[model samples]
Target: MAEGGITVTIDDAEVRAGLARVLAQLGNMAPVMEDIGRTLGNLTEDAFQASGPGWAALRPVTVARRGSAAPILQVSGGLAGSITHGGDATKAWVGASKVYAAAQQFGMPQGYAGRTRRGAPIPWGDIPPRPYLPIQDGGLLPAAQSEVLAILTRALESAVG
Candidate 1:
């Protein structure tokens, strides 16, 4: 011992005992450390893409008294279709007569294009009675006046609540 009760010599038994205690503690924390490492690797800058240049820093567009006088479904042949506030967001094979006939010919169940509240279509064997879009005949499907009135009433009640 060169200083106050401090021995700098190698002690084999003490070193082994300290190593065993440290290994036991690390053994319990190995899985937790691996999970934390994986989470840190996922949120890096190169992992996900949010939007293009200058997209995040722009304010959203707002328009009052919104009205567009076109029928909701128009064939742009691409993803450029625009819809205003009152436009029908639900456009699928549900209300199409050709799709209905094809489903019948292939022995598929009727009214397969149903949705949950979040608007995902149900499969062939699993569908509710009501579809997301109600069936329309030859002309354009006009919004029912009664349904609009009911919606307005519900909105007023919700605003009061």
Candidate 2:
């Protein structure tokens, strides 16, 4: 792709275009989707409380942004711990707290940091960086912003520590 060395596959470009379209769609769904996230959490809480191990075994567990990534907590007794994904950071995600510590401490092998408001890096490393939101106002967000923003926000909010 970098000027004439490796031949770029058609599928590669198709995937990129498809992702852009998805991002635009996500921009439209941002607010409502955020609410849906809350509802799912609430439903899980109620169901788990009502019945023992209601969703624990199958838990829709996704450890990283990519679905292919192996779950940090697949079907363990939960000392293994679940992972999160985020989008537009409603709570502090791309903030000054290293999420990796928790993953390491809890015995998670690997995880994703997720994205910021417009797909910027959230905090990382043993020392977390200060949260810097490139687009403070939602109106300033670009069309491509949603995919990263949406998932990362959810992940960090779910992680919280």
Identify the leading candidate in terms of TM-score. Answer: 2
lDDT of 2: 0.31
Tens digits of lDDT, candidate 2, 65-132: 33543332233423212322132422211211233323322222123333222444433322222111
What TM-score, to 2 decimals, does candidate 1 have?
A: 0.16
lDDT of 1: 0.25
What is the lDDT, from 0 to 100, of the residue 39 in candidate 2? 40
On lDDT, the candidate that comes out on top is 2
Error of 1 at 149 (Å): 2.2
Give the TM-score (vs. native) of candidate 2. 0.21
**Per-model TM against the reference:** 0.16, 0.21
